[model samples]
Target: MSAAPELRRNSLDLPEAVEAARAQYAARRPRSAALHAGALEVLAGGNTRTVIAYEPFPAAMVRGEDCRLWDLDDHAYLDLCGEYTAGLFGHSEPRIHDALHAVLRRGINFASVGPGEEKLARLICGRFPSIERVRFTNSGTEANLMALTAARAFTGRAKIMAFRGGYHGGVLTFPITGASLATLPLPFVMADYNDNDSAAAVARANAADLAVILVEPMQGSGGCIPARPDFLATLRALADETGAVLIFDEVMTSRHSAGGVQARLGITPDMTTLGKYIAGGMSFGAFGGRADIMALFGGKLPHAGTFNNNVLSMAAGGVAMGEIFTAEVAEALYQRGEALRARLNAVGAAAGVPLSFTGIGSMLTAQFRIPAPDRPYVPTPGEEQLRELFFFDMLEAGIYLARRGMVALSLPVADADLDRFVAAVADFAENRAELLRADGVTG
Candidate 1:
């Protein structure tokens, strides 16, 4: 007997699936929709941060406690995004709260230099191996900008070497071809990330004019791809050979280890830019390195910001680094992240799907692809649709993550929460097995 009419392996149309998901998301977040509508009257596209904006609008989170976030519609989710790695301490950490409270009670801002700034600077210099004379900025963007300025001033060169897909803040993003429209116009030499020969060629081509070779130890926004150690070492050697300053954009990767990615890789960049959780969830950024280079601001070049040494950020950052994120604590967190990623990968393998996670330490990006032996690192075309579907699915499962499938583990994230997230991922893979299989995704 012939099999009753062959069944369709992938019956779901991607467009239709996306539409249905958007509709479901909208239906579940009426309050968020209303808020977005209200915000449109004031903010452009009803959003200020482009990264957080998504189709059919985004959720308006109301409050967060520990690793949980409550959105406008009162939906609670495990905050795996971790405020894009800014909330490493998570929301409402008792220590951070108490520290900020004390700051508020004593003073909010002081026009003059304060003891808090010096204390925080000392703490940072001690923790980060490369930093010797740290200077604070209001945001990572500011910190990166200042770092580049220092590099240019020191080298007396105008050209910079940056990698494609490396983000150095809002104004310093370099995509595949050129800098983003909003990025500051600079003489940039773009090179392929993690490609040693490409980077060396670029650096050598502009050696005379190369002021700084800026890079992230791990590309946080570029799918959380970590740079190969050999590649970083090559960049280091190139910087030395060309007399170009090397700047490590450790704003995101700093959370990975006590001494940051540079320390982990045993490659000391001339300068390191920091931000995110360094201020204990407050507004913060810092750039510092070799004493001679950082000394530019002392007399040679002027760097000033009204809030550069804001009392609250300095106090919170000092406590967070000195007390909360000690070496032992960071090591434990890194180990936990390693265990979680291994389990997540195992889940994908058992499902026989070409799903993989890329990242180092407490950060990861879940990627879906059609299996191709020759192009293993290449993502499948239109795989973003699958990622969007996964985002909606995970959100529905009470797990929240970056729409791009990025996750940053917070200190408050419990072992049970990680297990739950992995289980959720397994469910997604199994439930969508037919679609994945039809997409040529294989073991």
Candidate 2:
């Protein structure tokens, strides 16, 4: 799903260097340029998804193999973007790939329940601490919608308490940039992330009507900013006090551990929403927690979708959870990510740029901010320019990550390839030192 975020914006002008880089970007991707031009006739702005709409046009990739991708221009890339954390097993995982093929052999559109669905559901319920009884959805967006609906149905309330920069799904985004027109019309008590006092205040004010408090353990599109432990604890406490269903949006963060961030932090939520890498890269999402809360479905609060338990996704996701991404592999990949992030941060420091990598485990993002951020977004003047420049620079060196600087390391990404990524990052930090040190840029 290329799954580029509909995250950031552009209002201020970029530096001349960025303009030059953009030109270089156009020069290198002639085939992509023509494809995009042709595509514009049918697709909106050469994209159906909003996130793929980036400055200097997004590259048109033809195919991918284990940790690598080939673009329309024939440029090869080390895929650090990891399909926005959805490609955890990499492009060609034998087990997951085999599962999909096997499903096709069995045929599709089975009108009744399939064996694969029950097996996959058991695996998911076993893995997540919050999910005692689970239900499937086609995407994370759908899972999050159902989660909120369940919360409302269970609590008989109307409002949602979420963070300023939280992103539950396409329709559930509440960016620090501003209100998105596509956001769901559900009442929101938006609170600042990592600010326990303020978040507590807002939660209490809406406690009477707040049915759910949905949040990401890390703000994936909001620059991978993690929620402070105490901030989450405060929310947990507030939910207990207010009778709200605390929903952890682990769509991206679920890849962090075998049980996810809730296990990492040792804080359990009343409900959990999951997607991204969970389905072995097939379109998948699940919502579940506490058996009593999930009983909404049994009470016949309808949750329907034909593909909710499609054998392809269920089979592939079962392979992903039960076979490929086991507890040991999850731990090792996490260590690899920590080491990589540390090295990247060291490179930025040595080059004297206010750049750092943020997020936990194999999923992280490159952030151009001072002293790092505990909040959702700070929105400094030149932050967007720096992010764009860094993106083009990475592309020129054949390392592909999200334009917003998000990186989600996949299981197949080799250590040597990681070393090369670090070297490329060091090169970028060295080359962009002056621009980064410029007063308004990193401030």
Candidate 3:
């Protein structure tokens, strides 16, 4: 409208463009700015969740309905974040709301066991093929912790083979370049994802003491990198040969289908960990597998949590699994997600830019790297700057996605909203292709 502000790497500078975007963002959300300032006086860095903490502070959302959200500044946005895949039913899924409300009427904590837990357990066992005997947790992080603990106890071994780019939970993260400092103090043998040889070598080296081979069918926090089917098969074989348990962390990827990516690939692991959308947006997590392994929890291995099977989570999870997320619904959602990702990638390709979206079924990450990362965490030089700029641009366009360029589609997001997101990407490509390709070489 006003000649596009004329910012460039060799001229005005890419940082100049970012500054301009930040200025616009700040101007539009004065109220949110004050709120953040106030939060800074209390919360560390003005945030509770690390992922949501970004530069210039994140928006405080006030309300949401269906696939839309209203920020504190009263700016309406199409919610593309979907609460990091935990909000699959969207802001106001009547079914989930009703279930929670009904649970409240039945009563709060009985200080013992409840009937809803059994219903939820049955639904989870029925849907997920690898889960024969399941146990609940307050979060996916807990689920993975217990799963790994079980493996160690069952095998009488301590070593675990975890992928470099894999993330089981907050305390169990393995980054591509190096390991996270917050990672649990456990004997971890890290291998590269999507590399059979790397995994094989590690598994063999730790064979004697290897307790489990933990992986994600599709890496979520690791930029949505999908593992090659053969790589998974190799892990399965290696686990069997080494007498190690194979655990699939489907906390996020379980949204791929009713039975998760495991069912789609026809490869069953010894154990499975699940969370995110499983409880219909309520806080929930579960870990289960061979009866012999889970049976330990009931006997020797003690699994204790104040709200492991809370009424709200149990009821909501049961309704979500049994009614809302039926097999047919899963199949349809999967198809829509596949089609949406294809269209988004096509827009990037057509723009002749290096940007691409990588993921499976309703989950995706917009990245600047091409050919999609196979293993090593070494990122493309200018990949991050491009995505940071894209994040600001999309936010300005009223599309609420993760600052890290994550997009998790909800069931309520309409086809028209999809078109709008694609259009926004197209505009970003056209407007920033030169700066993106120049790799920010400043004058």
Please give the CA lDDT of all the candidate structures. 0.85, 0.86, 0.87
Candidate 1: which pairs clash? none
Q: Give the alpha carbon lDDT tens digit for every residue of 1-443 in model 3.
A: 11134432335456777777777778779999999999999998788899998778688899999999999999999999999999999999998999999889989787788888999999989988888999999999999999999999999999989988788889999888887999998999988889888999999998999999999998888888888899999999999999999999999989888899899899999999999998999999999999988889888899999999889999899899989988888888889988988998898788877777888889999877565555536564466667778888888888999888999999998899999999988888778888766653221
For 1-443, candidate 1 gives per-residue lDDT tens digits of: 11011111246666556567677778889999999999999998889999999989899998999999999998999999998999999998898889889989987766999988999999989988889899999999999999999999999999999988888888888765454898888898888888888998899899989999999998998888888899899999999999999999999999777899877779999999999999999999999999999888889999889999998898899899989999889888888988887888888789988677878889988877523221114445447677887888888788999998999999999989988998888987776776665553455
Q: Is candidate 1 or candidate 2 better by TM-score?
A: 2
Best candidate (score: TM-score): 3
Q: Model 1: how far is 391 from its true place, Å?
A: 0.6
Error (Å) of candidate 1 at residue 177 is: 5.7
Evaluation by lDDT, superior candidate among 1 and 3 = 3
Candidate 2 residue-wise lDDT, 373-418, digit = tens: 7677666657778888888888888899998889999999999999
Give Cα distance to truth, residue 89, candidate 2, Å. Answer: 0.5
Cα RMSD to the true fold for all candidates:
4.2, 4.4, 2.4
